[model samples]
Target chain A: MRITALAGGVGGARFLRGLRTHLDRSPGLADTELTIIGNTGDDISLFGLRVCPDLDTLLYTLGGGIHEGQGWGRADESHRLLGELAAYGAVPQWFTLGDLDFGTHVVRSQWLGQGLSLSEVTTRLARRWGLPDQRITLLPMSDSPVETHVVVEDEDGQRAIHFQEWWVRYQASIPAQRFQAVGMDRATAAPGVLDAIRGADVVLLPPSNPVVSIGIILGVPGVRDALRGTTAPVVGVSPLIGGMPVRGHADACLAAIGVESTAAAVAGLYEDFLDGWLVAPEDEASVRLPRATVRSRPLLMTDTDAAADIAGAALDLARELAA
Target chain B: MRITALAGGVGGARFLRGLRTHLDRSPGLADTELTIIGNTGDDISLFGLRVCPDLDTLLYTLGGGIHEGQGWGRADESHRLLGELAAYGAVPQWFTLGDLDFGTHVVRSQWLGQGLSLSEVTTRLARRWGLPDQRITLLPMSDSPVETHVVVEDEDGQRAIHFQEWWVRYQASIPAQRFQAVGMDRATAAPGVLDAIRGADVVLLPPSNPVVSIGIILGVPGVRDALRGTTAPVVGVSPLIGGMPVRGHADACLAAIGVESTAAAVAGLYEDFLDGWLVAPEDEASVRLPRATVRSRPLLMTDTDAAADIAGAALDLARELAA
Candidate 1:
């Protein structure tokens, strides 16, 4: 089956890792072509270099070169460049460029500047890293620039902060009033983005930030409409399991969007498009959706094996919906 | 007394290292200010990050953090970031970037993007690196972008390549017809470049690439004018010891510019502005100069002490001219 997944950064990367592992292990699922539509809202320009955080995280993790300890950047990372940057009084000191990761950004930025679309650049990067050919395709949400900005009221006053500062710099400590994907209103889905969704036999939404990750992708023109009208079952895994996020500042983002941190609220957000919803067994009572048939399963991806098992369960639910 | 020095990358950095030692040990030069005018001809935009090769070399060397073995970059350097860059297929792979040195480039690029002058950025970077207050003022030749391009013709075709590609990638293996500083004609000298020369008590040119390094600096508007009019004696140490460069592809550059790789040929280039010329003792028999008084010395800087001795001999020549 051709399964397409929509992803953010950490959570999306983790879920994709599991899905990849599951496909590799399952005898019948070996032919599954996985196309990942990644959110580029978290992308930013730093030191005059374009940095796509989510795309890099996905690339590094899938390529087997991720820094396991930091859970981001390349393995055996060095801070020599970052130290020099700091010494030069570079602002927004919190967002660091690991030496190994800087290379990726530099290459990506160079290719982008040379008039290659994000999708084309991504394919080239993936090919260079020796990623499995034709089995998995990683697509940025749009070729156009779209930033996730957070409206916050700090002691200094109200202002819109870039997503990186709101997340990495402030660590989400301040009260955020709303999360806005700045240019999403005018952004058309990158070439092949909507097509990937329409062509897939199954579409899986991993437990990623709804307001920024999948939400930003859906916010792109015609993307949500395509997903809603697709004949294939669109399944979503709850970002909230037992009233808490699996990782990251999802709770804060959830609060910013005024959604209670619960599986039901998350399911409700995707209700119109979701044909199936998977929630952790502990949050079985919270699974209430009108359009989607909700199923409760063991959803904690604590390890690679556990993650694969979770992915398998989701695929099984999708198969049941197909039946 | 205030001294001005013209420099390139490794050789220039080494000479300055020795010069600093000499000045530090001299009782009469206890309060002397040293201003270094560094060559930015080797500067290139890699992956869109501005890298000033010669300036970083000088900074790392004078700041007591240079890689002793390489005579460039920082000691205890790591290639973690560079390895990652390669993994992403960055072009011009021959010019390696150590993790520590990358920090300097990142900071400078960041500041440059924010509209800071190269001189101002250099000062801030030098301060951050704990360079002694007022001990040395490093100046780039021009704030405007100027890249040294070598016009090479081979059996198949002919094209002008960037200095980095010619030196690092091809290692100057090809025969070159000419050397051109692509933007020099319209470029103005960087702020404080002329002022440093105008205010100097003595001006010394290190054994750097005469054609690309010192030559490019002179090509900048007002630089040669400042040197010609300065009351301070302008003296140059021969980069060509016998009939060859001590390091780098200076010989190829010299050939490209139709100048023989000889001490006298190098000294002749600065004849109009120079007051004294320092050539290696071996090349004294071949040396001939009318505009400047020629002096013979052991010019090879084998170690810090040797470098200091060379600096001392050059300064002594300047002192003799003043007397």
Candidate 2:
């Protein structure tokens, strides 16, 4: 069976790892072919180096080279390059880009500079991580640039900054007035995105930021249409549990747009395409879905085993909906 | 007194280190201002990063961060980026560019991409190393591209390869027919090259590769004219000892032009502008000069002490010629 997953950076990758583990541990899912459409809205070019933070996180995590504690970047990484860059007084100093990570940036930036589309460059980079053997395909949501920009009110007035600066530099502390994924009006989905959705046996949304991760993907032209029109069940695992995010600044991002950081509100936001919803057991009583099949599960992914169990529950819900 | 020096990479850097030490140790020379005209023939673009090998060696060495044993690059440097770059199958595997060294390249490439000349970018980088405190100003031989290409007879036929490929990859084993500094014809001296020569009290050429290093510098339009027309006494130290180069593939490079690796032969190559020559004590008897004052010293830079002594002797010779 072919499974399509939409992912962001660390949290999404963690969930996907669990799903892959669950498939391996379970029988019938052995031949499952997984194709992940990753969010590229967070991608940016700094110092002429193309840095795809979300896409790189997926590559490093799945390839078993991720900084396990941080869930992003390479393990045993050094910031020598970044330190030296700062010494030169290069701007945008808050981002902690590692030396090993710079290697990926250098290669990707070189390819992109040579005129390769973000999607094409991403697919080529995944090959280095042994993606074929893992039966996992990672692709950017679109070939064109769709950078997310956040509008905030400073002392002067209201202004916009790239999402990276807002998220990394400010720690999302300032309330964002609005979030906009620039260039979404003209950009269609990447080459295989619609095809993967149309051909999938099931579509799973991991526990990633709904505002920027899956939300940005859905903003692309025809992406929501494809998701809503696909015959397969579209299941979502809420990133929020017990009125807060599992990890990341998702709560802050959600609050920027005035959405309560609750599992039920998250499910409500995806009510159009979501056919099945997996909420945490603690918040089961609070969820009020009009039509989707809602299931309660222990959603604390404290360990691999817990993550696998949560993933198992979500898959079971999707299977029931499909039947 | 104002002193100007011509230099290359490792050997040139070693000589400069010695010269800087000699200036520091000698009485009444503490206030001497030094300017180094570095060869840019070995500069290459790897993975789209502008790497000026000769200028970098001078920066790292004079700035006290050079790999003391190797006489080039940074000490305690890591190749994590280089290793990962190779894993991605990036080419030009022969050169071992360390991670710290890559920082310099990245900064330089970015600056060059921003429309800064190679000379301007170099001066900005030197600021980070406290060049002013060292009483040193380093400039490229030419702001325009002046890459040396080596013509060699391959199995297919005679073809020109980059000087780096000829020197590093082939190890200079293939007999070179000739050397060409591509784009040297249209290239003029860098901003201060001629001024440094005209303004100098003494000019010294360190023991560097005569053909590719000093020869390429002189190939730039107006550089040779500056050397010959300058009122300052010009002196050179033989890289060749009795009948062989002390280091590098200089002997192989000189052989390409049919010049014997002897003290008198090297001096004859520079006979036009040379006013004094410094050779090894062992090679003093064989030295034959038509016009320049010839002197002998222990030319092997076995240590800083030995190198300082040689530098001192060369400066003394230049002073005598001036008188």
DockQ, per model, reads 0.69, 0.67
Per residue, candidate 2 scores C-alpha lDDT tens digits across B1-323 of: 99999999987888878888899888999888999999999988888788888999999988878998887789999899988888777777788888888888888888888899998998888888888798999999999987899999979799999998998899999999999999888788999999999889999999998999998988878888889999999999999887888767889998999998888998888899999999988999999898999998789999877888888999999999999
**Alpha-carbon interface RMSD for all candidates, in angstroms:** 1.8, 1.0
Best-matching candidate per DockQ: 1
Cα lDDT, model 2, residue A176: 92
> Candidate 1, residues A1-323: lDDT per residue as tens digits?
89989999877887888988998899988899899999999999987778999988888888887886666787877667777677667766689777778887767877887898888899988886556563888889998999999999978899999999989998899879998888876788988888889988999999888878888888889888989988889988888878888778888988888888888988877878999989998998867788898898888878778878888888988999989
RMSD of 2: 1.8
lDDT by residue for model 2 over A2-106, one digit each (tens)?
Answer: 999888998888888888889988988867989999999999978768789999999998888899888888999998888777777676778888889999999
Candidate 2 collision pairs: none
Positional deviation of B296 in candidate 2, in angstroms? 1.4
Q: Give the chain B TM-score for each candidate.
A: 0.97, 0.98
lDDT of 2 at A198: 83
C-alpha lDDT (0 to 100) for residue A47 of candidate 2: 70
* Model 1 alpha-carbon miss at residue A156, Å: 2.6
